[model samples]
Target: MFCPKCGATIPDSDNKEKSGSKVVKNILLVLLILVLMAVSGLGTAAYMMFHNKSSGATYEGKGYNTPEEAAKAYAEAFANKDINEMLSCCAIESYVDNLDYEAQIERYGAYMPTIFGGPIMTGDDEATRQINIEERKGQLTNFIIRAYLRVSQPIDSPIFSGLALQVGDGKEYDADEVVDMLKGASDIDSIKVGDVEDCYYFLQASSNDNSDKIHKTLKKVYGGKIEWLGVELEIDGEDYVMFVDAIQYDEKWYILAPHGTGASIAGLDVYSGGICELALLD
Candidate 1:
């Protein structure tokens, strides 16, 4: 039976054979459509994932030819004052010894304003060590006297040799000064020039700026927590360890010179933190 106007389900009037085949075909078609939809969706998802990874700038800017190449490149970037390029190369975390991001960034940024242009130039051919410290000159707008950083210790100590190294265009000390300074340290404090003939000495510091005033500056190198950090430097093409002593100069402690290598001083950066120099690695 069928309803008038509104067609309703009724007993099949046509052949059962035809109805059964049509029903199976329709169901199969629906299943095939579902399968195709699933495959299509999966394919689309995979393609999108790959595309996203490929497109991201962070992923697109790949890195160094090699670790050494990367380091040299970064150094060049730094030397050239290419801030963004250097930062791009700099690791998010360099090492356990490395300063945190804000501190390091601020430190590096400070160099940008002046260093890229040149070290201050002066006609005075004479140099302290190798640094022809052309006075801050016209660059420094605030001529107001900066608080002198010099501080002192209660005890007077014998000062020995000194070695100063100025890397880059600001090359400060010469090989001669460095050699003499190292040799002199032996006579300071102990007055015991060791048996080892022709001993070498190197530039010593915890960090870049805070040299010369080890006792005061050492505290800072350790972030005021530990006592000291050491630097490794090449001297006369030979390398040696150093223990520093500072003297008050102009209300600041200058490296009156260092008190030679202590009796049992370890090599540079052996314990203190830094990107250990090649000498240290060797």
Candidate 2:
């Protein structure tokens, strides 16, 4: 026993006790800080989601959990002519305010031919310009929501019926009236959605040196991380693919509009075709 005690040296029990206590205190301090950070982050995310919903910046209904779910919902909404459901499927309104209004107006103006046959008037004053911008935004929003419905649904569809556009020729016609005038037309009977494909490699392949700029712009507008998905759609026997820019905040996914050069950045040459092409009657 004596030899064993000597070998152990009964070494500094008080010092060992103090050292162990210090280590425990340090571990507890680190854990406390980690807990606080997690709580703060969660609170911020919750606030954003609530604010978006309450302000009408995003759809009030429950957001789709996955990108595929969002794409399918959009297709179903288009086929069913459910404008509210279609709006719920997209996150476009959430980030529309973040875009350059002038650039957006210019970009979307190209689609006016498909929706209306006249120029949207604007004034030179700043206040008038802003008003015009808001009006144009509303018109585009309506067009996007109703364009496909006009093609697929009958003229009796509640949303389209009695809604008429007066063109320059003073002739008033609704979507069905316009679509009927197109030659070699095949109205969309149904829409089928395909699997969602990742757009990372597509971005990497196309961005070249401006990849950093593209990514930074997206992050600034959307969030820290964005998921780009290409959803394939089969509309009335023809195949088409649409790019969906999505962002996840607070564990929920929201689809974003490809504002600015987002479509070009994604290597999408969005020519007038498919829905856009069919919407135009010349």
Q: TM-score: which candidate is best?
A: 2
> Highest lDDT, which number?
2
The C-alpha TM-scores of every prediction are: 0.19, 0.45
- Report the C-alpha lDDT of model 1 over 50-108, residue by residue, as the tens digit: 33423333211244443333434433442343445544443211111122324333444
Residue lDDT tens for model 2, 135-254: 444543554544454445533444344545564455555666565544122355676776666544323444455656655665664443466565556667755555556655546565
Cα deviation in Å at residue 268, candidate 1? 8.7
Flag clash pairs in model 1. 129-173, 130-172, 130-173, 131-172, 150-251, 150-252, 150-253, 161-184, 161-185, 162-181
Q: How accurate is candidate 1 locally (lDDT)?
A: 0.31
| Candidate 1 residue spans exceeding 4 A from truth | 1-55, 92-282
